[model samples]
Target: MIWTIKKAIYRAMHGSLKVMMVLFNLPEPELFTGAGSSLKIPEVVKSKGINNVLVVTDKVLMELNLLEGLFNSLKENNVEYKVFDDVSENPTIQNVEDGLKLYLEGKCAGIIAFGGGSPMDCAKAIGARAVNPKRSVLVMKGLFKVRRKIPPLFTIPTTAGTGSETTIAAVIKDPDTHEKFAIVDMKLIPIVAALDPELMVGLPPHITSSTGMDALTHAVEAYIGVCGNKLTNENAEKATKLIFENLEEVYKDGLNLEKRNNMALASYYAGVAFTRAGVGYVHAIAHNMGGLYGVPHGLANAVILPYILEFSRKDAEEKLAGLAIAGGIGTPIESNEELSYRFIEKVKAMNKNMGIPSSIKEIQIKDIPLIAERAVKEGNPDYPVPKIMNQKECEGIIRKLLP
Candidate 1:
């Protein structure tokens, strides 16, 4: 009875949120896509009258010399830039602070987030700190707490996952507590995004597989969630179709720029869907896994996705069936139940094909309680999930991930 009341309250809150979101008039990032599109961002920055900019990335990308082209392009555009490549896989508050220090000291007029979600998230938080110097990122947690506009922000997504390039979210971990929390505000959306497949041509197979699944999770969650509007539904469906068709193909042949570009667009579409409609337990559980076990976000999402779908399958059956149809994996002749089951099975098969583990080896049994607690806290009253879960239920589902 108490759980029933809680769900009612959550639904009511979500209803109000839908109204608020419409009032917010959320903006999508102006996108530049295709081969060598990343090179165009520097020119856009210069056109915006930004003379100096900060580039946020990670050491792995820098080591591979992926940024060399971007750097040279910036120079050719006569745009001075500073580099902060200390962003970890799961970005910490310290990463933001360190990057903010560079942005301030260099007097950067804007920020260019280069790489996957981590650098983009760190850059967003740094920009948040830049504009609202008095507000700690801790205080900026939850929805719409950012007081002012962030600095002019641009994103170049090297991986077609996380959709951080178009998202209004930045997930940051507290190193002290190991708790990962997202700071969500419409102000966090980037001013521009470049979906350049040229940059993703060298992505390792593991990254290609996991991040592609991350985009799938985003599309699935957004489509099934109750908060979806027509726009979110359409974007999610298109993203689902593109990911289903192109992710594995690109995974096997990373040099296929067309497939890579399709995956990139799919990621952006999924990002747009979830940014508006919201994600569910897949994200909630995945965030905790990343926070506690130092697991890669995409890998965590990929592994946990099948389990969450099974749990929510009954409730999300119609939605799943629709997605299965959209993804070209089902026909109208199939019943909703059959199509839903097929969708979940397809996800499992994809994980197997890509060598993604069904269970997380890193999830310690001792930490299950804390993991479940945080996941429920992050999910409830916020994510408009198809079905609500209690702590005990969440714990049970997470336990299955133990290897």
Candidate 2:
């Protein structure tokens, strides 16, 4: 009788979940990333029928000339291109405005963003806004405004992080509101994502570590998310395995192209996974933290990953246990609930091993109430939190981390 009742409950719950799944209308970007063939930027440009290209990058990349090889490729293929390497780490609306100015001034047919998330995101906004100046980038937030027939976009990620190349979402800060808003649109998906591990060899250790954590966060969130689809599961598993294997090696030695390649693949896989499944409380809160403080997005995510995962255990125990196994922690002797705790511990250990700090004390969340309120308001609050976090509970969590 008990077993029959349990089965009936399970069926009813799953039936409701299936109903919800059909309603959200998720999106998944087509992924094209790997190593060895990452040097085919010119081929990608040609395939897109691109005549002139605007390469978006950072001033640091320009100084390092990390893109010399790509420039040579453009020259080798007799491809006409303009360089717009003025973007910053966390790009502002003005950056997009400036890049669009250059895009129009050069009258370029396409854009090639050849850097980390900031540059890639900037390029997407510039690409989208260029096609329809009538529709503001801010107004295009949330799902599916990326439909405009913009020029072709080629993204070559220099960092084995961000996975921005593989995601349809572009994050740009609004100066008026000071929020790191996300523009999720299929049209923002790059026409081609060129993955070259050689380009990541120049990344410093700090960046490599932070970005690896970012990749890990994506995988963790996607694997256990409410909207996690089977297709996302396939990619998330690959990302989890690759990140577990290669993140340490890349941190220890950034010049190892093979390790960099694997890490790059991990980031790409996680990006693909989360682009559809969507991230959870960690990302939502981290986004707010980034907006309020000048915290690096990856660092902010890394800091709160374990905390959020611990809180999420109440709702996602089985999912967390699954993550544990994927993260190489076999099922422990305890219940699945305990296994979830083990998973959280393992993640904490991984962060510590990778030199990621535990708290936002570095960013100094002195005003705990303010940070918590903003974290919930700018993030979860009424947006349908996956785990149902109340204000006091959220503030309590933030306060606990302050020691």
Candidate 3:
């Protein structure tokens, strides 16, 4: 009964948000893609008339020297910047607070998000807070809450996943609840995004596979969701094809810049597709897994994706079948149902080939109800999931993901 009421409230909220989105008609960011596009970040910063900048990133990226190219560009351009490398795998509100503090203390004029989803998300949250200092990050949790324009924000993604570079949403977890929440507003969108495959070449095989699957989930969910339109479908189709073709090659030979570039483009395309159309139950549950069990976001999404596809098959058959053909898993002559199953099998095979485990070993049975409740709360109405799952149904799905 509580879940029913929560769903009704979320549905109502989403209905109003759809109306608001149409009313506002937000614009997407300028994107630069290729092997050396990240070198353009300093130029973009100068063009925006920004002097001092806040660089939000993680220690791993720094240790790997993945940020050297961007740092060199900034130095060559004589741009002053402060680095805050404390962002966690699942960024917390505290991370945002700490970054924002640094941004203010340094009197930064702009933000350069310099890593994966966590840093990008933390940077956006910091940008939002810089503009709206009166409101808490907690108050800015839902759609269209950010009314003011944030400072100029630029992104240089070291991973070919999350698509946070192009998306207008940011996910941050609360320290008290250990639950993840999102800030969805056009103001959170970066002014510029650099999808430079050169930065991604050093990713380990496991990271490559997991992040590739994450991109796949974004594309597949966007294609299957009810909010998808013709433009989004086109992007999703292309993203699916690129990921299917390039992910394995890049996973096998991490230094292959050509395959790496293709995977980066696939991630960008998936990001664009899902930013407008939105993702589905896979992300909805995966976010909870990350928050609750410390599961890596990409790995969680990769493991949860096939099961959700199976659950959504009845409603998303034609779309999934189309994706199967786009992904080269099925011929045009195959029936939609057969094609859909073939697509599911292909995903499973890809996971096996990439060394992504089928189940999450850390998921506790006792936590399913809470995870299910949070998943439903996060996905209902807004996500346009083929089937709306109640707590019990969501628990059933999570049970299958357990070791």
Ranking by lDDT: 1, 3, 2
C-alpha-based local distance difference test score of model 1: 0.94
TM-score of 1: 0.99
The whole-model lDDT of each prediction reads 0.94, 0.78, 0.88
Q: What is the lDDT of residue 120 in candidate 2?
A: 95
| Residues forming the 10-long window of minimal summed lDDT in candidate 3 | 13-22
Candidate topping TM-score:
1
Candidate 2: list runs displaced more than 4 Å.
1-36, 331-334, 362-367, 381-386
Model 3, global lDDT: 0.88
Which residue pairs overlap in candidate 1's backbone? none
> For every model shown, what is its TM-score relative to the native structure?
0.99, 0.89, 0.95
Off by over 4 Å in 1: none
Residue-wise C-alpha lDDT for candidate 2, range 241-321, written one tens digit per residue: 788888877888888888888998889989987776667667767776667666888888888888888787878898777
Clashes of 3: 0
Ordering by TM-score? 1, 3, 2
